[model samples]
Target: MKLVLAIAPDRFRDEELFVPQKAFADAGVETVIASTKTGTCEGMLGGAAEATTTFVEVAPEAYDGIVIAGGIGSQDFLWGNNDLIRLVQTFAKDGKVVAAICLSPVVLARAGVLKGKSATVFNSPASVSEIRRGGATLTDRDVVVDGKVVTANGPFASKAFAASVLSVLSPISP
Candidate 1:
């Protein structure tokens, strides 16, 4: 399956983007990296990724899942982005997997897709408040999955978060 991975132009957590991306690649899933603009996106810790397209270029129907990578830039660039928000909402409405890691969950919350859902974000008062205000039941767990929506608390939870998303994309039989 193909997926869209959104990151801010700057300050997206390095592992939050790379780890899950590696998982998807290993599973043979195609991913398109998107940011506010096309080109390179820098991470908080000096890692960089080339954004294959701009957020506006994303077509929700073309992908099986959407993952928003987070960091301080998420608040600066993604929090109020209407297009990104609409993409999240559209993926949810279409029953596609929607996942976010670290502070990125706030984007999903703000998009109104987290309402009445159980989610977890980085343990920051502001992050917690954003999810709660959006009507989500906040969890302190490392990872939380509510239907097609999956959330991870912070950088440390990257692996578990990616696994949760992969499970949704390709479920394992008993």
Candidate 2:
């Protein structure tokens, strides 16, 4: 089965986390929630759900793709995470899809994954600079699909973000 892994932090935007989770689940993909610690994760949109699993470390090779949900927590972890950066870089280098939305792209860029690829995020020029500095094509849109790397904007783009992920994972029957 195609494993859709959501690397959810302890605090992320509600729609950013759950919308894509629900999308992957509805698409018949086996979804797994990987958090910093194994337990219930608090969402920014006033929702709470327990993570199915937690890992102190992630190799990024076991899953078909990794979606790093973004919010305040992601911003906090955006930089200075050598491990997470290495993980995202490794996943992308292996030709595996690695996606991030909102501020998480800042993390992805810091990991050197977004360099030269088109992507989107939730923040402003400073955030785009982070990705651009990594050599990525930063876009101010709801969803940007540059190769296997997909990214979305903010909470308002939740539906489009989920649809973009679905489209990337599996295009329509038509």
Best by lDDT: 1
lDDT tens per residue, model 1, 1-174: 899999999999999999999999998999999999999899999999999898898988788989999899999999899999999999999889999999999999999999999999998888989999999999889999999999998899999999999998853122
**Clash count per candidate:** 0, 3
Most TM-score-accurate candidate = 1
Model 1 regions lying over 4 Å from their true place: 170-174
* Candidate 1 Cα deviation (angstroms), residue 22: 0.4
TM-scores of all models?
Answer: 0.96, 0.86
C-alpha lDDT of candidate 2 relative to the true structure: 0.72
Worst 10 residues of 1 by lDDT: 165-174
lDDT of 2 at 85: 72
Task: Give RMSD to native, each candidate.
Answer: 2.6, 3.4
Candidates in order have lDDT scores of: 0.93, 0.72
